[model samples]
Target: MLAKFRQIKTSYFKLLLLACLGFFLVSLTLLFIPLYISFQNSIVKSVSSHSLKTLSQTSYSVEFMQESANTVAEQLFFNSTINQLLYALDYNDIDTIISLNTLNSYVKSTLFIESVYIYSSKTGNVSFSSKTNGSGFEHIDDFYDSDYLKTLKANESSRFIPFPRITSNDKLVYSFLLPSSRSSDLMFSNSIMINISAKWLENTYKSIGNQQDDMILIIDSNGVVVNQNAYAPVLADLKEDPMIVRILNERVNEGYFLSSMDGEKQLVTYTSSPETGWSFVLLTPYSTILGSFANLKTIIFAIYFSIMICGIPICLIVTKRLYVPYSVIQNKLVDLEVRYKSNHMVEKQNKLHALLVFPSPFSESQVLQLKAANQFKVRFDQPYSMLLLQIDRFADFCDQYPIRDRALITYCIQNISEEIIGKVVGAESVQIDRNGVCMLFNQTSELQTRLTPLVKEIQQTVRKDLKLSVSVCVAESGHTIADASQIYQTARESILNKFFKGPGCIVYASDETAKKRAGHSEYQPARQKQLTDLIMVGKFEAAKKLLSEMIENLKDAHYDYFSQIILTITLELNNTIQLLEKANELTLPFQFNTFIAKINNMGSVEELLNLFFRLFDEMDAQLELKKKSKNEKLVQEIIGIIQRDYRDVNLSLESIADLVHLSSSHLRRLFKKETGSSIADYISRTRMEQATHLLLSTSLSIANISEQVGYVNSTYFFTLFKKAHGITPAEFRSKYATT
Candidate 1:
């Protein structure tokens, strides 16, 4: 009857186990559905976040430009000087020139506006443009009055006009027509108009794209491409995509969706700008994003399916094999329990190690009871000392040795220390942490003196016998066994001082105090200079060593004081470097914001030193490169400025200084250093060159050419022309003229 009942019970247990395994597998598989859903949601969220950020950046850029336009228009409406200028432009009287001066000032004050025009229905058109010569209106109007303007004037429904045309040099020019202000009768009355280059918009849009596959489209509300441009060319019409049509019809402000067009899967994002009522569209191939997900899902499903196939048979076989041996295993467990109870000495040693390493706050009576309970217990009658041995270059050691070998090495170190110290005095060895071992021993005198020789023995054994280099530090003697935490803390601090002392040297807490004569040394100016010199010379390791020494030697160094010192050095370094950058018009590759974030997270002096080392190393390399290129870049900038604004009568050293954010004397020195010519001489040369080109190439008159090349005085222009070309302006033009 008993045998039959056992068989039945075993069969029932196997069935029960099978039932639980099936339930768990079913529940796990059910969870995958929600997991997949969550993953899908996460993908959408990530894509939307990126899309929204792109939308925000693009919108901000457009709004920023539009807002700048609105500022000028706002001034045109509100400023009496500007308003009077536009209204009196038709008279061509004294106020007409005053209005032109005012308009020129506006163009100079603004960044992007190249010219300004005022139109009156009663008197036709009057314009002030930097590109024009003289107080000219009709000559400037010759080319600008294209059929597009005529068509735009016929409707006047929109103030923002899009016109992209190729210049004579084959460069595509972006042109926009902006009406400056709104009035009650805008079409019939007076109006101010402005012309600006739209190249900045195209460049800004192209800057956001990354690869050859990406495309940027500026689409209107009617789904037509208003502006055609980007770094990469779009091969397909995005408006015809079903997802884009759905997004437009849904009137979603901003989002991303996957679509297919021309047999290519595409990821499309669209956002409508509040200022223009036009949508900004970004499109890339869907394969770029979702290709990895497909493989990931397949691998994940394969793993789970394998587990389902393998789990049932393993459970069944294990259940069938275990039941027959139940009685014999139960008897062996009882015998093992008896043997475990009999071995009190080993258990006591384990208890002692546990109490030392883990938290065990005990009263004197409780401590006494614990001492009585353990074979390797501490005797409180004598003073105690804690010696901590830390593995030097522990990470290297870990990487070189396998786990089992590392465990054996640790055991060997512990056994050697215990065997040596246990013979001489009452000492217990414990593995306190990875790459660290603690020796808690009772001594009759100062532990530092007594344990100094023992540290040498342990070091020799670890190096000579075990082949591991260790740095050991011994703490001051404690009065009782209960002082383990404090003693261990001091010993750990002694090991921390090893950051200053190079590895393989044993250190002691007594030596640390003796080194600090005062609680902390005052922060020094010479040390700061030394730190800067080290960084400037690119001696990063030496700088790190010096910083660590300074921190470890500070008299009662709190984290706040050390942090302030570190931060002061960091910020001062930044300020000094930034001043250099500004003077040279050079930008370093170091991201200051990222540096600041890492600096803020540094919790210790060592971490701060490490961070500054990296920061300074990168900065030093970039600064070296900048130094080599600084003068050349400055000279090139001056040349570019001269090329762009050679027509400005007011172009001078001081004006160029303000434009390039450098001192006039500094710009002069650098320009001469780089190009062997002064800025003034270079500007003169540039003007003469352009003047000669105009003389040879175009039909512009001599006085017009003089003004166009930055000479307000025709007589002075003729004199310079003689000096530069050995001929007068008319003579030069007559000599070079074809007709």
Candidate 2:
């Protein structure tokens, strides 16, 4: 065993291992010593502070309990039986024995009293006792002859004396004294005794003691232990403990004292009872009080050992792999942060002034803000008009291109808009999805002053680059941006104006104002009445001439309503022209450009008459062609309806003629001329078409379809359907309706 021990101790390999182990152990100890000391000190301080807090709490609790007991005693002393005894002392024949028995029963049932006594200093009368014989207190005059009685007599008031021995129960009692008015001089002495059970005091002490492993005691002013834990021997000799003696001598209400008790150093914290003149003391052992810090030191040592054993090797391995990437990322991050910080102050200035360049959606809050900021009044609130311009053949352009190229085209259009408006007006705005731009100006004067050059610029730029024509519609001034959406709708209507009046033009709301003021002109009210009568009779040309004369008068007079009257006439002319074109497919060479320019320049009735005559001639030609085509289409539609319905057995040339409101022969001839076939042949073709549709679309057999199409014979229906469609019914069904 000795040789083996030496081998284990002296082996070179093992010595190297032991050396490493010792080095680690020394390093770990040195590292952890300061931590352990700090942890230990912290725990000690925490425990000490907690103990002091608990001491204060316990002291307060003791005082509260004592006050509660005093309240109970005061309530008991004022009982009806006790009050009767006080009143009955003045009457000699009041049967004091009955009252004393009543008081005894009252004390037993109502208060937690062992016994109660009423003592008279003048008559040396002690009327109550718990003893069965009632002989113990009969001669007890000197017993009540104490300093407390003297003090009570001197003060002529109530006094509470705690922890007095009551011989009736052989236990500590709390006594209350009130000067009885029935005394010989009404001043000497009055006293009351309430012998409380010692078990109650013991139970209160036990309650405070059970909160912690501490010794708790209740002691009187005379250095006797009234209530204390049975295991605490230090409290048995109160005279030997200077802290207790000092407490009694000093009569401090509350404090802490450090002293030796039963040869062991301890802490004593005490509080005096306001009700009973006794003090509650808490005694704690020093070593036990400080033992709570051990776990903290152990935890700190464990943490230090873990760091020493595993931390360094792991850190070194991780650092070796991470150093390069981490350094690169760190340097990049540092550069980015520095750049961001430096550019932060300059970024606001670099933001593009897009507010003026983009059209704002008219939201109520934005309008309110504009109003509040006075931007609306200052910028757009005056007699400012709106112009909404849209591209005419944009859809055709998009449909002709690939999606990517379409997007590029749209981008180019936006670029063109920016360029044109940016150069001409100096104030440019755009709404892209709507494919339009809005131009606001003070009035028609501003628009005409600024717009001619701008429109020329736009026409030149779009014609050169995009080869697209542009149409514009201008709304009269005095509307806000909130009404910009309505203006955009009006502009859409104006695109049709180009077709009615001719292309490449600008139209204004004022162009429609003339019709609104037709008969209101001063000259020839009779002519105006004649014009109304002619329009009612559908003599549109005569009415047109009269309206032209009225517009001429307003223009020559330059009346306040001239713009209004002219706009109305222009609107009426545009509508009449559109109607004529739709009915006749007529073409007009008159351009809206001339009308807009003439309206912009005309200052007399003769110039207005010239424009009106030009408009009327174009419209009359359109109306003549519209009437002819309309009559032809009506005749052809009647013939098609007759052919479709002739297969019904109830069908007749008369009914078919009636459906188109014509005589049977006339319908017959019309059908023949239009279709190059007789009515009977057309009916057969119609039947074949219905048969073919049913055969391909339904599961019904050929015979049923034949009957449904007014062909009685299935064979004939099949023969006719095949001749008309070049396929038999079964073949047609197989080709188109295979399930």
Candidate 3:
């Protein structure tokens, strides 16, 4: 038994050696190069796709977080408790200790505030407290005082005031200011300061998740790193990377770059909080995620080698069986080819390889002669109508289905086409194009009568069976394959006509109607003259009437030229009316009503024509007056009252309404109708204008400006200013120097 087993093993070893050699040869000839290329392409595509998805997700998360932070900041900046505390301190009736404690407690509970401080400009007193320690002003010189406080006071409309500083403990902190709500006439103005801790920022960064060793950082508009998880990186070190610096300065929301810290390539996604003027960044490393695909390549290679080894013996076994049958099939195919060439007739060719060409009816004599000489008969001689069927929004359909599913959809369409053609006029060849299917039919006069039923049947098949919608266009019977391209063009026109008439209906192409509609003259000169006449005198009512009349005339005549003319006139009239209304609301000292009256009273065509030129000049003058009077005061009585009672804590539209002896709603309506601005907007604008002058000229701090401008909360005041000016008061002052 042992000797017999050894003999069998020797025979198996010889076969295995032969199989290995064949596998190596086949691999070298066919599989290795193509398989390696396909593998590499798949790996690169997969990595790129995942990278893009990760970048997109990271960008969305950062934007969402930044928006949340801005909302929280806005709420804290507008809180009334901080406003009252600052107001009391500015009045000098309360001690700093009491105000600071109240503010610190409010900050701790209301916001994620870690520390609070109050700085006074008059007494040079600064009070500060944190969860760990409480401190009072030790040396007046120890506090860094610049024009920053004065600037903040001057502009009461700013919300978040960012200042970078290194604390006594040698840790970087971002200090935000909340100015006091006190009048500029007061001797002192108090400002609330909040110190943001790195730990507090850790809470914001926690949402970014772990993306390798890459760290998330928050930076201000000035490129200062306000919060970073990485250790000991200065503004200069952060700016060393050009992309990071660009993101900080330009507020680019999402991008990719290489880090300077470790020289590792990364996809960096960023978003700017327009409210705070700070940027948030999320950085992810590339190699950490894409490296795993390398292992996949090794596995693919092993499977490919095994397949090649197994395929060698299988090919050897199949070759013997296939040789005799393949030789017989090859000889038969050669004989058929020779017979087809000698006959020179498509019908004589084998069924599998036959090509069917529909000959033109115009060339019937020559086609018949060729067919008869080759022992083939003409299939049909009657005139035929053509139908073009197409799907709407085909590109959208392609996007919804995967490639394999799309192939199935095409196959289904082909099957349906065969079924329809077989039922109507026997099974015929159908040509598929990018838009839809093209079919030829032999029944000439019956096309118009039978087309409706056929179309209904096609619609039912597509909707009920294939779950798709299709539109069909049919050409008249006089058309044939000789005029195939022209017939197709007519069918396309018929489909477009359905867009105007309604959908799921068939249209027959009429050459006479098409030609008549195509050659009409366009009238432009008369329409232009009419529009110019109405706009010059600001006769908006008459202009609207003339435009409506023109549109009706275009529709009645069914002229494309008139339609174009009416569209142009309507657009011009709308724009002119809007301009005139805007000018009147701004209280420009121009007689637009008088000019309109003159245009309306014109008696002759010549006079009306002359008015067109004069109207343009008058409209131009009104626009100039508008630009000059944008800040003009038509309602001076209301303006003076608002300025006087601006510091009143209960000051509002209602209070002003009572003082003026009118109802609140009535006053608001009248103000907006005459001024083109709502009551609240007018008040806010007045306060902001006053605050701007004070910031540039006065020595008052931000708190005084807030009270002087009628804002009970100085932080609210700053928030409003930053929204208007696109920067904090201190930054605004640095940008624009006052003499």
Tens digit of lDDT per residue, candidate 3, span 9-105? 7666556556545656766546766777666656545544444454344434444434543444444344433333333334433444554555566
Candidate 1 per-residue lDDT over residues 166-280, each given as its tens digit: 3334333333444432345445434555555456666676687544676766665555554555522322345675555676675557777777767887777778885666677
Q: For model 2, give the 10-residue run with minimal summed lDDT.
A: 348-357
Off by over 4 Å in 3: 1-50, 61-381, 393-415, 426-436, 444-448, 479-481, 511-739
Q: Arrange candidates by TM-score, highest first: which order?
A: 3, 1, 2
lDDT (CA) for every model shown? Answer: 0.67, 0.56, 0.56
Per-model RMSD to reference = 16.8, 44.0, 19.3
**Cα-based TM-score, every candidate:** 0.42, 0.31, 0.42
lDDT, candidate 2, 54-146, per-residue tens: 545555554554454456445544454454443333534444555666666645563345555666554555556453334123424454324
Tell me, by lDDT, which candidate is best: 1
> Model 3, clash count?
13
